[model samples]
Target: MLTNQAIRNVANDLDRRWISDDYFDLIVWYETEVQIHGFQLCYDKPGRERALTWTRERGFLHTAVDSGESKPTANRTPIVVADGTFPAGQVRREFIARSGLLPAEIRELVLARIKDYEDRQSA
Candidate 1:
């Protein structure tokens, strides 16, 4: 569970978070209600890190992280860059396997969001 105030705090929104061995990080947000409004899941920190972001209004976004290491000499800030495709199958499976520690509702919602993304992709 992540408790960092700077990272977790958002105006008029509630959050649930989980972090595992620096490899996987998940944050789900709700707007003062039971319904989830958005979430951001980041994975594969050791390699080419990527994130799957989903918002109720904006939908899903898959992005690769630029760890600011491309130029060792320059101190650059890490940022998210466009990712070509979302590996929906692998990510959904992985999330199911690792999200056992999260609350059942939160986990289920995340899975449902992933499924929604997959359905959109296949359409």
Candidate 2:
């Protein structure tokens, strides 16, 4: 769990980020009162990295990471680009399985968000 003070000092908002060796990064934002505002899950870091971003205003967006290596720019920064497909089943299974180390406060919220995204997609 991230401290509220740290989040405020770094972002001027309530945000938490979890980085793991499990090849996924989870970033979450909260509105005042600790209500979840949004979250972005970046997965498969070693191979074909992708991001699943969900926001209260924009809903869900799945994107592939453009590693900025194709053009050979001086500054190699990864950017999110539009992705044609989201392997929902694979991502869901992998996330759930690997998220065991997450803190209890955030684990369930992220899992629920994943489920919500899949539900919306199937609907």
Candidate 3:
């Protein structure tokens, strides 16, 4: 299952930044050992719109973006660039909508995580 710890690890380790969110999922830009790019976590099951070959059916499907920018630069028009997935739980879309993870909801979690990471860096 997609534990909260996993998300925190991504935030702390990957330098995560929340850019956009919608009814389906949210997009995040993160840095890895090699490059910086964006990926998405679809709360619901994979859609038929794109040729998404999910890395996991029961977890969040993490797909690569063409560029580091989100599609449409506002909302997601998910285009399958690569196949990946996170072991996050398949929570309902409504739950995520009110989960304070999105920009419209609350930024406390994001800010706190960023602060924690920065503090660790300076320590």
Candidate 4:
């Protein structure tokens, strides 16, 4: 599974510019592939949190906890997931793409990083 540490590591490795825009989707994919329960991504706005909650409530995967801050939040408090194997990269990429993000390469890269992190953790 994708632990907070692993997710953070992957997020840290990716270009922050790329990650800031779509980290939630990566988190959701990681959580779903790993079959984690009650996972949450802490954000600053209740609206963002609510958005994540909507996704989770729909049984998509994961949730977000908005910190209610005025300023836009950085990638604080990486998402956590119970330990488990994730889906293959192609499958993960497809999943994220379907979620509405563009440029398939971004999701592909994220999935690659996630797999790398998971491998390191297991090793």
- Predicted model with the maximum TM-score: 1
Per-model TM values vs. the true structure: 0.78, 0.76, 0.22, 0.28
- What order do candidates take by TM-score, descending? 1, 2, 4, 3
- lDDT for each of the candidates? 0.76, 0.75, 0.37, 0.36
After the best TM-score superposition of candidate 1, give how far the Cα of residue 113 lies from its true spot, in angstroms.
Answer: 1.2
**Could you give me the TM-score of model 1 versus the true structure?**
0.78
Q: What is the lDDT of residue 85 in candidate 4?
A: 34
Error of 1 at 120 (Å): 1.8
Where in model 2 is the C-alpha error above 4 Å?
1-14, 71-73
Residue 9, candidate 2: alpha-carbon lDDT: 36
Q: Superposing every Cα of model 4 onto the true structure, what RMSD results?
A: 13.5
Clashes of each: 0, 0, 2, 4
Where does the lowest 10-residue lDDT sum fall in candidate 2? 1-10
TM-score of 3: 0.22
Q: Kindly provide the TM-score of model 4 when superposed on the true structure, using C-alpha atoms.
A: 0.28
Query: Candidate 2, residue 56: CA error in Å?
Result: 1.7
**Candidates arranged by lDDT, highest first:** 1, 2, 3, 4
Give the alpha carbon lDDT tens digit for every residue of 1-123 in model 4. 112223333552322221223233233333433332222222223233322211334532333443444456654554434333333343345445443543454444544544554455468
Error of 4 at 31 (Å): 29
